[model samples]
Target: MIALVGLGLGYMTPTVVFDTFGIVSDTTGGAVPSAYVLALVVMALTATSYGKLVSVFPSAGSAYTYVREAMHPNLGFMVGWSSLLDYLLLPMVNALIVKLYVEQVFPTVPSWLVVVVYTVCTTTLVAITMRGTSRVNLVLLAAAITVMAVFVVIASYQLLQGEGAGTLVSTRAFAGPETTLPLVLTGATVVCFSFIGFDAVTMYAEEAKTPRTLPRAIMLTVLLGGGIFLVAAYVTQLRFPTNAPFGEFTDDPLPQIGHLVGGPLFQALLVGAAFVATVASGLASHASVARMLLVMGRNGALPGRGLRWINPRTHTPVVNIIIVGAVCLLAVDFSLELISACINFGALVAFTFVNASVIAHFAVRRRELRTAGEWVRNAIVPGVATLMTVLLWTQLHSDALIAGGVWAAIGLTYLLVYTRGLRRPMASLEE
Candidate 1:
């Protein structure tokens, strides 16, 4: 349950709910529902692959560990390096969402101030203890789920009363006159960002009471979270078919949707809930980033000893938490779209490798040891996931592709320099 909530709710922020509505509407010509359905299917396949890997190698390093054990250390380093783009930028994106939500409620508050407050608060909350962070996240997730449930009820009531599209049941959100296959695919690629944290459940495998249950938990997390995301997108599209009102709120649309359904008081409550959700997301992202850095530092893959230092009382990497907070301070200048694209790019790349890792581990190396069922579970399923993720990767925005490329190039450079032109290993093999 902890894995499910942490991975599912941690990524399904209110900002994601709104931003996806706008982005998918722009790309799919109002067929937001179909696009979300496509993304959900693709994510479900990817989640299946992650589950297989977790069952085989339940470790804290996530893709980094899976790829290294299955394939080679060099490729594993690249996968981990690519994942840094997602892990490092997620806290900033979450902080930006909080800033946007607060600014929406109190327009006079400066963006810089909001960013500072969010970063400081989130970093402090995360640096305290894992137990405390989990408690806070559970509370925030419950509140977010309640607010969304109310939203769905109110939106359904409004639709029944001849508002917006003037119909409670319509295919307009799933298919419009202008909707095309290419457009829906583009929207699906963008919507894939909302599913980023589903794989994060694997990071907690080492601590799980029964490692065998993690695979089922991963699938449930994706299914439950994806269902909520699809419903949110569907209802939001129904409420605002044209996507024009979203122009006023490029960062958030839930508050506006709340206003349309239940007036200003409800809108304020939704905004407050959204703020809490963003903070929860920031805490989760910050903790993941700190753990990744700590793992890499312990392996001597990172440069500094700072990331390796853990406080005895707290059992937390204080220096890495501080560093992540400092980086999040730069969130004030980044646009939501750019941040979304880059994050999706990095996550997609890492996911692609995870799929490949499964095939490499199960099919090629242990061909004689596996039954047909195991072969299908380990190879064929992940192969489909690889293909789907690669398709989405091709559909990423140009900015995202370029940014990811540059980040990858930098990682390659570090690997080459650190290993003296690829002649030596990147991390110690003793572990």
Candidate 2:
């Protein structure tokens, strides 16, 4: 549910939610589709390794569990810490997006009030998350899917009417910004966030009704989500003039697109969809991150013993969920610039560790494996993806790098204290 909220609607319809971040053909230099395709390819290789790991070790911690089993315990701890960095910081970006849309509807409202309101809404949702995951997520999913469908209808209808021809372009003519490689890489890093949620399915391995069926679901979701996003991006570009500043479209790109192609109703629906989409992301991020923390706690990586406490009534990790919620609310107070930068920094680190985990797993099993084709899935693909993530990290701001470094430092400090005090020998490989 949380992953669905985060990556489902707005990810594909980035034009509707975060148009300022440069994921569309017009703003990103006509290479939005290609960027997504590239992301898909990167994830596909990683996903193959992920599929094997998840099937063999279907646990709640997702990637961390895989890393712990396949590699050194300290490496697992690092990946778990990195996963927390990704989840905790991403809500800052989401909250900023929410604040922008809120300010759009009530332009006279103070920006601080918008931030406060967004923080409150996300926190309230987090509070409710401790109660149970079912009721709230069901409602959010319904609303998100409905809003997406409405936009699709409105956008498709407008296209049928032969309006906004200048804004839309043929796929053959698509050429993204012919800028310097660094600039393009920076933009591509931003674009990559849209494709991050397909892995969320692995996190829910424990709750899956049919665990074996999940690999197919993950693949299907990625393909379907990617395809829909491609169409949405093209249609959005066709409707809105490309030259508009990203800041102008940050609040409600769909309404602007609606105004250009259709009318007021479409605009209203688009705003509604954007809000629902943001809500979905917040919820999913909440759930997934909390689970990662719980897994970390269970293995003694984190200090709090109570982090593993599960609610008997709700069957949820109450303490972890509350902590994640509080952190996300804090993120709302931050500037969007910081939030976006933080997300890239955290995710890149986690992706790097995940690729390393895959490589280690394949190496350990190489002698046992008879198949000649295992190298690409286990070794070569993971290597390239890891390099790509590390390269992307180089393009991030120094502040983000510093912030991520600080976070890692803090985690390492905590781990060091725990290990020394307990005499656990954590840095050394554990049998």
Candidate 3:
């Protein structure tokens, strides 16, 4: 349940949905659930591609790992570069979520201070004492889910008693006024942030009892995650059809919704759950990315002993952990909106290549698509998934496109220089 639920709906979905509801509502003209529906469809299709790829390359299989073996190493480096951007920003996003929860309670604490404390705590813990927190994280997940269930039940009760949207059964949440394809797609882009970690289960391909089970886990995680996301979006949309009543809280409606629906006690519980979830997610994302940086440094992709500096006593990458903490300080000035967009931008870039890797590995290179089923699984599914991901790309905000583009350009330039203008290959290539 944890390889990844610990990161999936158990962590990101509630936070993203509670955070993005207002954004999606404004963007989709009050049809947040509609956007979620679109995003879920896209993610489900992409999950199939992930399932296909991880089955073949089941050892610690990631987009970078799969594309490297199937396509070209240079291309895989580019995919890894893009994915690294997303991985790096996710911890910061969790910090921002912490800031929101802290701000909700304190109402006067500086956002910068909250982020600093959070960053320092998580970074220091991972560097000094990175022990198993799976049980603790699971307890937190249960607490959060319980709180959410209470909130939804209260919202449903109010709906029956004729409040807000005032009805339990209606298509208003899914197809409200002025909801168009572009608007919904734009909303989907924002909500896709919730599903970012659904594929993360594949990273544990090596640890899974069986290789076949790992890919299925990826697909199942996406589907189950989507179910939770849609239910939350649907109910919350009905309870608060638009962001008008939210006013300043439109940027973050979690606390405000709690108070409005069930008062301060419920509000505190909701914000508390947000804090627990963020801390769990923050620690996990921070350590994971820091170790990723350490690996890159050791492999010559990063070209620095600083990131490679392991603590003698703790045996963790102290330098890289601190570096990630410093990056998390970016949350002081960043909004959840822009950070999430940039992360999604990197995800889409990696996802597109992952789908291509499927075709390049099985359909094109293997040339074994004699049967209709093989052709559909290896070629057509991934082909359509690639298109779906590209469509989501068109919906990304301008700032994200620019940010991701610049990062990709830097990676491409670095690859060219490191490979002697593509004549040589990336470092550590024994193959």
Question: What are the models' TM-scores?
Answer: 0.96, 0.83, 0.94
Models ranked on lDDT: 1, 3, 2
Q: Residue 214 error for model 1, in Å? A: 1.3
Best by TM-score: 1
Q: Judged by lDDT, which candidate is best? A: 1
**C-alpha positional error of residue 381 in candidate 2 after TM-score superposition, expressed in Å:** 2.7
Off by over 4 Å in 2: 1-27, 110-139, 149-169, 177-182, 245-255, 366-369, 421-431
Error of 1 at 210 (Å): 1.5
Model 3 regions lying over 4 Å from their true place: 1-4, 10-13, 129-131, 306-315, 428-431
Runs in model 1 with CA error above 4 Å? 368-371, 428-431
226: Cα error in model 2, Å: 2.1
Model 2, span 112-206: residue lDDT tens: 66666776676556545533443454465567667656665676666566754433345532344463345556655665566666666677777
lDDT of each: 0.81, 0.61, 0.80
Residue-wise lDDT of candidate 3 within 1-431, one digit each (tens)? 44555544443545557877888899999899888888888888888888888777775537877777789878878888898898889889998888987787787998888888888888877777544544455567677777777888999999989998999889999887888999999899888888887666665565567677666677777887787788888889999987877779787788888888888988888888777867777776676677667656766777778977888988777888888888899998888889999999988888888988889999999996999999898889889988888999898999999999999999999999999999976664222
Candidate 1 has what TM-score? 0.96
